[model samples]
Target: MNSEFTIAIHSLALLAYRPDHMATSDMIAHNVCTHPARVRKVMAMLRKNGYVAAKEGTGGGFILKCDPEQVTLAEMYRLTSMGSVKPGWCSGDAEQDCMIACNMATVMDQLYAGAEKQMIDYFGQWTIRDVLEQVRREQEKKPGV
Candidate 1:
């Protein structure tokens, strides 16, 4: 739901794609098509969560610490966008006397929460490794990736 989730997934997948499963933020940012600072922010969260380990100084970067097959998209969703599936604004004006306007926001909130749960459940079915495989398949379809 948020860019952070996608960036985290892409950064992790890039690490997994490499032979040693390690890379600097610059490399990840280039591969993910995002700015290096954005990559660093997401990488910091990933590192704090034990999914990655960072090293300091020259020739140092990040190393994938978790098994891709054991990490699900649902986990990333929870970490970055668990309650973000719902919109912050609703179409209703609670000050109005109309019953629908007074209750629309509440109803939409419930609906969005339920939908988020279902989406998270669906995301649970796909692991990081599955995502990597998807990337590989996409690359295979290209003439020269």
Candidate 2:
């Protein structure tokens, strides 16, 4: 749910479209309309998560570590959004035994848990290849003005 998650997904989806060629950070940034540094930062995270591999010389860039069909959005979300959950109605104290605390905090916690489960389940159903196909279909459907 952060920019990193979105950017990483975008980068992977782009790579999925062209699996045979490595994509440079600059090229990915151009598609993202952002700076190459930003792309590299996200790429580093993806690399750490074993989703991408990078090369270190001229004519080198990034490539998928595995097949796009093997990468699920749930895995990407877990990698990019680790330790990023926070309850909306609770203070810094995530665990308090007060009666009032139990009411609102419990409801909020359950809501967040449910939301996370829904997100994971939804994303787990699709792979990067599915996203690329959807993007391609959408692009093909645009009418000329």
Who wins the TM-score comparison? 1
Off by over 4 Å in 1: 19-21, 93-95
Alpha carbon deviation, residue 107, candidate 1 (Å): 0.4
Mark the 10 consecutive residues where model 1 has the least summed lDDT: 13-22
lDDT of 2 by residue, 1-145 (tens): 7778778889999998888899999999999888999999999988887888999799999998868888888888888875356543463333667766557766767778788888889989988888898998899899972
The models' CA-based lDDT, in order, is: 0.91, 0.84
What is every candidate's alpha-carbon RMSD to the true fold? 1.7, 2.8
Q: Name the regions of candidate 2 deviating beyond 4 angstroms.
A: 83-98
Alpha-carbon deviation at 34 in model 2, angstroms: 2.0
lDDT of 1 at 15: 80
